[model samples]
Every structure is written in structure tokens, then in C-alpha cells.
Target: MTDTAVIELVEHAPAIGRPLPDAVGRALAASRIVDAAPDPYTAGQWVLRAGSKVGAVTLNVPDCAPVTVRIVPKVPIARLFFLLGYSLDSRGWRDEQVEVAEHRDLLPALAQAAERQIDRALRQGLLQGYRDAEETSLVVRGRIREAEQIRRHFGATLPVEIAYDEFTTDIPENRILRATVERLLRLPGVARDVRRRLLHQRARLADITPLVPGQALPEWHPTRLNSRYHQALHLARVVLTDSSPEHAAGALRIDGFLFNMNKLFEDFVTTALCEAYRGTDHSCRLQDPHHLDEARTIRMKPDFVLYGPDRCPHAVVDAKYKKEKPDGYPDADLYQMLAYCTALGLPEGHLVYAKGNAPHTAHQVRHAGTIIHQHALDLDQAPDGLLGEIRSLAHVIAADPPV
Candidate 1:
């Protein structure tokens, strides 16, 4: 009882407080995590379920040490669309085409196409009625009404007579008549007087929304809109329900509209890059495939190839509209630029991403005494900041001794 000594040993898991790996975090940030939960005892570790896929992450924590922890992201197919240019808005499928294909989910794209087809059919029906009236002078007559008429027969014989009349047959005249007659009948206007009863009847049959004056039919119209909508919907349904390449191609055309968003982004970046590097003795060449003599084939089309001061290869940059860096290292991008560098005999290249809040990164991989540098340009930053970063890069290139 006099001398009692106790030594307590505390064992703790590795610093579970450490943030998740960069790749996992990026994927999670871009995706929708379905079920994210952690054990109370092992708060650092988490089991995450995301869109038909599941994954786990164990944070690294030191013995009994409190450290900042970042949740790991789950990998799932749903994240694919976020990686692409599609985004969510209040409207149902704001950028449906891009979002569907970005996720590589053909079903939604096909469904959208099918819906478009239905709309197309409706539009076509409307326009066809107009065309029929114009071409054949076939006015649509509403239900004829029968009125009792007295006729002289053996006595006063009662006969049923119907009222009907004809009007001008020109397409424009018919269109006006139809529109006015329909409008008047709907509102019971003075234009529906008995004097013009027959004309009104004819107009009612041919009534349609008149085409705007001097305005040619729009690519999208009442008829075309409904018809194309339905056609697109049908085609989409066929595509989604089938695995045939034909169906896939049709779905891909719908997907093309999505890439248009990226095209717009690319154009903006291209313009920015051009403006920043103006007066630098650089020429911007687009889609010029550099031939790799050894490979005996066209290597790639660098989006923009800038010839620097003294006619040196200044920079080779390719614009990517992806929301997140794929595979963390931008390897695909690096590889693409490397091919350009090798074919152009340049020492370095640049990979410009449309989004990022961080400062630009310069990566150099030495090969045969030539340093192939891959630089990242974050276009989301202020224009001046971006311009400054670009200018700094230009200076760096100028100072580096050609390897």
C-alpha cells in the first residue's frame, strides 16, 4: 500500500488526421457521395458509398495527436459527368447534352434525344397544315351547321341547308384569313358577322399562326420544334435501349452539343492567351499536326503553338475543359504535350486547365540533357494575375539556357 506505481501505455493508430490523398479528394469534391460515415472510435477512417460504388479511406494519425483531417472522396461512375463540362441548374437538365455524355451515360442522352423527336413531330404537324393550306388551297372547314330552309314542293317542304363560302387562295392571304378567323371566332369578334359568315367558316378551317412578316421560317418553329423534339426523343430511346453502334452514333450527335460548351471555353482561353502574349513575336498556329519523323506519322494538333523570341519554340499549350485533373498528375495532358515537344523539337510544353484557384505549377522531366517542362495555367484567376503568371513564364523560358 505504501509504494504503488502505475505506467499506462497508450497505443494510437497512424495519424488518422492527415488529409485524404489528392486524387481521392479531387474525385470526391467532383462527385456526389452517397453514404459517408465514420466510426466514433476511428474517426479518421471513413466508409463512403457513392453512386453504385463504394470505397474506404483510413486517415493517417500519430499517437494521441490531434491533427487536421480531410475526408476522402469516393470513386463512382456518376463523377464522370462532373469531370466533363455539364452542370446542374434549376432547369431540368440545363446542359443536358454535355452532362449526359460527360458522365458517359448514354441512357439519359438517348432519352433526351427521344423527347426532342416528339417535339419535332408536333412542330411538323403544325407546319404541314400550313403547307397544305398554301399548296392545295385546302382550307380546314370546321363542323358545318344545318339550318332549316323552306322549299316549294307539293307543299312547303322543309329542307336542311348549310352555310359555306370561299376566300382568296394565296398562301399569305390564307394565312392571314386563318389567323384572323380563328382569333375572331375564339373571341367572338365583329369580323364573324353573318355578312362574312362563309369567309369566317373557311378561315376557321384554315386558321393558323401567321408567319412573321419578312421573317423566313426559323430553323426552330412550332412544327419543327415539336417534330424534332419527338424525333430526338425517339432516337434517344432507341439509342439508350439498344447497344448498336448506329444508336450510339445518334446519341453522340446529341453529345456534340455538349462539347460546344467546351468549345466556347476554349475560345475564351485562346483569346486570353493571345492577348497576354501579344508583341512577344509569337505566332499562334491551330490544329497544325506536327509530323514525327521517326514515328513516320502525324503526332498531334497542339491547340496553340507559340514561336517565342528569336523564332524559338516558345510554348505548346492544349486547353482542357475538365473540371478536375484526371489521375492527379495530368499524365494524359503531359503525354500529349510531350509528344508535341518531341515532334516540334522543343524543350518544354504547357498544359492549361480552365479551372483552378492555386498558383501555376512547373514540372520538369529531364531527358537526354533536354528538360521537358509541363506548366499549368489556371485561367480562373484574375486576368491580370494570369497575364502576370504568363509573362513570368515567358521570362523563365527566356532565361533558361536551351538544353
Candidate 2:
């Protein structure tokens, strides 16, 4: 629980339960991530283990991360944010970047990102505090609801939908972000002293979640000063999606916070490779697949399929966050890559593992008529270095197979 670490949740990994101070333990009880587990000690605290789902999370509080009874995990939120932020930027999420805190983890990191916007929002005057929109209703009216109510509600204005001009902070976007901040503030690890301040500041915002992303965002004029609000709203919307909200009996409960590095790595490599191959004779397609059977029920999806001069799959590449040992690679991965090669009518496929462990090597599966290349990319390398690995990877995937 050092200042700089976040919790890393490995898929199906076990964590051990440990003792905690009574206050800390009681506070943790409110969290859905940590739970009671079989323990040898009479004190009988709890353990946080990785769930069946694979993901990572940065915590604003200590002793969270909801792992198995035997695990003590620390994730590097700063590193992950840098990688994702880069990918997001390339995908057109541009902004004045937020600084990564030296001592805090993910949720706080998120809070920090939003805090700047929140401050700007306060200065600009609560976005929901501005002008009120006009509306119409039967009883209290800008216009008549008689015909509309007659057609829809049998002409009853008593139980009627009223359209009126009212100043309200209950709008969808504002509600979502406000709720997120309130939820974060209530979590265990958030600094206790900041809670009162944040609550008072956010008092103008009613914590609610009636609106989410797929609904259209409130449009803002593309002017210079309006940038902060837009960026704030965008960050709010993005964070809201990852942190799904649950409400029960007047309390907001969150399913533990986690980010899946597997998907992140897959996307980064796939997208970066595509960018590298831009303007080249060959085209790079990600998650493109061919059917494994005539029925099309089964699919052999490869992360990246590099096309060559013939307009066919020159090579199939798949990314792996957690890889097997070099001596004995995972059979499932072997089977998968082999299928990708066979279905795509290619002779070889490449599996990219994240940890910078083994040297790049190749193996041929028995009677499969295809060879599998295991390439390791060191995620600890600089972002540019990471991209360089993808660039070199392109040569291997796009080049001719060793006959």
C-alpha cells in the first residue's frame, strides 16, 4: 500500500487474506472488491484476490483492489495512463494533458484529471447554473398541452407531462460526472480531509445517473474558452463508461475498478501497426478473421493480419499480455495462431507476448502445416521504443515466410 502503487488484478489469480486495523477493515467492508476468506488466524480479517475477469485498477484509497486471499498487488497507474493516453490521442482524444501524481493510484489519478475540469467548471459557474430552457405543459405552461395530452393521455393535466422553464442541475451529463465524483469521494482510499471540501463544492450538483454515453452529449460551441468544459465533459463520459454504477437502497455501489491490460495491449499494438503500415503498399487489418467452419459459428480472429502484394494475408499476428514460458508455450495459443494461419491460407503466424522475457523464436506445430512465431515485447520500454517494436514486427509479419 505504498503511495505510488495501484492494484493489479490478474485473471483467476489467488490472493491471501491479512489483518487490518479495525477502522480500516470496517471502512473496507463498504467496498465490493474485498471479502472475507478462509484464514488461519483467529483475527479473521479478509483477502482480496483477482476475479475470473482480467483487469487492473488504480485506487485512490489504500487496502482496496479486491484480490484473492493470498495476493499483494501493486499496479503502475502512471505507466498505464501514459500508454492509453497515447493511444487515445492518436485516435483523436487530444487535450491539455494532466500530470500523473507521484504518490497516488488510478481512481485518484482519474479524480485528478477531472478535478482540473471541475475547478474550471466552478470558475465558469456551474454548467448547470446557467440559462434555463423554456418548455410547455398543461397546468403550468409556456403553451397548451391539451391537444397533446388529449391524444396521448386522454386530456388529463393532473397526471401530465409539464413543459416549463426551470433551472435544474439534474440534466444527464452533469448528473453522471457529479455522481462519479461523489462515488470516488466516498471510497476508502480517498484522502479523508478532502471529502468535506469536495462535497461542499459539488453540493450544487445532485448525484444522479439518469444519463449515460450513447445519449447525445450536450453540444458546446467550438470556441477557445469553451475547451475546458468540453474536455471535462469528455473525461467524465470516458471515466463513467469504465466505472459502471450500481444503486441499492440509497447507496452507490461500484463493482471493483479494473482496466484490462490484455485488451489495451492488443489495441495498442494493432492500432500502432496499422499506423506504421499507413502509406505502404500493404494494408493492416486488426481483429479480421476467417470462419473456422462452414457454418460460420466459430471464428479465428487474429489481432493483426498483414497483407502482401497478392492482397492476401501475408501473416497473422496476435498480442498476449500474459504469455507462457518459452520452453513450453500455451497450447491454446498455438492452436489459435495455427487456425489463423490455416484459415487465412498463410504459412506462419506471430504471437506477441508483453513481458520482455524470452528472445523471439518460432515453433512448428505437429502436422498442422503452419509455424508459430513467439515474439516478446517489453512493455516497460518507452512508448517510442514500444512503437519501434511494432515497426520491426511489421517487417516479420509482412515479409515472405521462410520456405
Candidate 3:
């Protein structure tokens, strides 16, 4: 078919006013709609065009009626070459119709698809890792094993065992190992097993050195570690130092260990939000702290701020990893959300938390004649349920006429 006819088939096959040619109709019958057209096409409209055609085309949408196309004679069929070439090269369009095959550089698209798959797998792995950490209590068990092993191995060679009534504990295996490795590298009389294990652990955790045949493992020449370990160490140090009562109670206190939890919560919230509003013209802004100069204080950084179609601030959402009470009265959280609403000039803010501690609740508080609504979201439900709650909240915000 001519390029114009082919273009028309693709363009008008999705519309209500147009009829597709017989060949285009066959393509439509075979095509699977990946993305549905919003606002224009009626329900049951076929948005994809695929399969083989025999000259003319017929198109139909279930409630909107159908149209027929007459094949134009002496058409160049150059469009066929483009379609065939694209279909041969593309990945996402593998199962799609030849006519609807999206032609673009395969490398970038493949890379993107691979990246998305990897990210999804990573998220799944992280979640499973947390669960495994909790369930297996691996760190405590591993520490105990290391201590026992050290006591057994070094009890005779070195004075590393701390004696007890019927049992003995190693001189805190990790510290002893660190000290022994430091000393052995200086001298030469270190146990090979001890040095080997320590080196292995360090390499696994710190990317210390490359292991190759016949080359002696390098001594513990410690420099600053990679960004990942450095970040972990920094957070750990903060948590260790700031464990005092005052720091715990302070509003802006940064609990370094909680940073990882914060990141996980952010990921969960972003995923939940995107799933909830899959096709909507809305986007989520994360970890952005909005300042209100009038208040003369830095307001709480919301976990997420959702924007509406017109680029206006729509709603603020905070995802709390902790559980809330059955009455849904998290006073501090409410106050924080109020601050966000005031600063953002939004009508509502959400506080989403893990469920089972409380039933869902909503509150409307009038502040300076503006009604600010507070909502309790239950994370214990399915992801789709969480998304539904977000969609409902967005609608609630939209339905409220300007205050």
C-alpha cells in the first residue's frame, strides 16, 4: 500500500469517525492494544494494527460502529518494506502486528528494557534480603559462629580465648581478627586460615583486591572504601553517636541507620504511586522539602508530592515505616503533614503507614479557614489496594472546590 494509505490506516484505525480498509481490518483483528487511547476512543476500540491484509480493510469498535476501506490501485508498497524491516529489528513489537511495528534503534530500547528488568529484580532482591535478615537472624548467628571458630583455632597459638566456667568465648572475633591481621602484615607469623578468611571477607565487603593464581594476597592496606561502604559506615557512625535520649526526641534528628529504611520506604511509595495512577497525567516528586519563609523553619520533607496535569501542587504524601494506632491518631505526623500543606498551599496531605495497628481513618481540620484533610493509608494491603487508596485520595483532593 502507499505510505499515505498506510499512515491513514494506522492513524484512523483507532478513531470512531473512520473506517479501516479490508487489509487494515485484518491487521487490527490480529493486533494487541498495548496502550489504550484516552478521551477519544470508546471502550473496546482496537488501538493496535497487526496481521496480514488482502487489499481492502474493515475497522470496528464495539459501541461505536465500523468502517471499510477500498484498496488503492498501483500503490508502491514502500511502507511494507519499512514495516517488514522494523518488525525484523524491534523487540517489544515481537508479538505485535507488522503494520504497527515501532521502528527505532534496538540497542537503546534493549538496554532500557534490560535496565528496567534489572531494577525490578534488584528491588525484589532487596525486599527478600530484608526479610531473610529478619527471619534468619544471620548477623547474630554469623558473629557467634565466627567467635567460636576463632576460639577453637587460636586458643593454643594465641591468647585469644576469654575463659568462662564450662565454656570460652573468643576475644571478640572481629576485633581480634582486625588486630591480628594488622600485626601479621607488619611481621610474618600469622595463621594462614585466619588471614585468608579475613582477606576474603574484606574483599567481599570492601572490594579490596583481585584474586589471581600464585600471587600472595595483599596485606590489609586500608584506604577509604567505596561510596557504598562509606555511606553505610557514615550512617552507622551517626546512629551509634546519636543514640542519646535528646537526639531520639528531636524533630529533625537524623538517625543514620534509618536512612536505609527511608530509602526503602521511598522506593515502596514511588512504586505504589506509579502503580496506582498508571495512565494518569500525574507524576510524583520525592524527598523534596518545601520551605515556608513565613514560618521561619524548614518544613518536613514529604516522602512524595504528586502533581496534577496543570503542573500545580496536588497532594503531599508521607510514607511511615512504623505502625499507627487503631484510631489513626498520629499527632506528630498530623502536625508534620499540616506543615507540608501550609507550605505547599495544598488542601490535603496523606500519612501512609503499615497496617494492622489501626483501622483506616480520615480527619478534616480547619486551619485559618482552610480545610486540610489527613488520611491514614494501610500498607498491609495488596499493592493494588494501596494504589486504589491513592487514586481515591487524589479524587477527593480534586473534588474539593477551591477554599
lDDT of each: 0.39, 0.58, 0.39
**lDDT tens string, model 2, 121-201?**
557565543334444433564544556657777856555555555555555446655755664565444455446656765
TM-score for each prediction?
0.34, 0.66, 0.34
Off by over 4 Å in 3: 1-263, 295-299, 323-330, 366-376, 381-403
What is the per-residue lDDT of model 1 for residues 1-403, given as tens digits with 9 covering 90 to 100?
Answer: 2221111111111222223334433333333322334434553444433222111111212222211111221212233222222221111222343323332222233223333333333332332323322111123343223222333222233332334443323333234333322222322112223325535344343544464533432232324423333323223322222122111221121011111224434544555456556676665665666776777665667787777556666666676654334446656666666777778777766665544412356566665333445455554444347557666755554455433
Q: What is candidate 3's lDDT per residue for 1-403, written digit by digit as tens?
A: 2122222233112233333443334334433211123224443333443111212322333332333332221112323222222222222222222221232322122222222222332232211101111111222332233365465665343323332222111112222222222322222122344346435433322321223322332222213422212222221222222121112222222111111223334455555564555577877677776786677575556777877777777777776644443356656776777778788887666766544323467667754443444455554454346557767765664455422
1 or 2, greater by lDDT: 2
Model 3 TM-score? 0.34
Which one is best on TM-score? 2
* Runs off by more than 4 Å, candidate 1: 1-265, 294-296, 308-312, 321-330, 354-359, 376-403
TM-score of model 2 relative to the true fold?
0.66
How far is 158's C-alpha from truth in model 3 (Å)?
50
Q: Which one wins by TM-score: 2 or 3?
A: 2
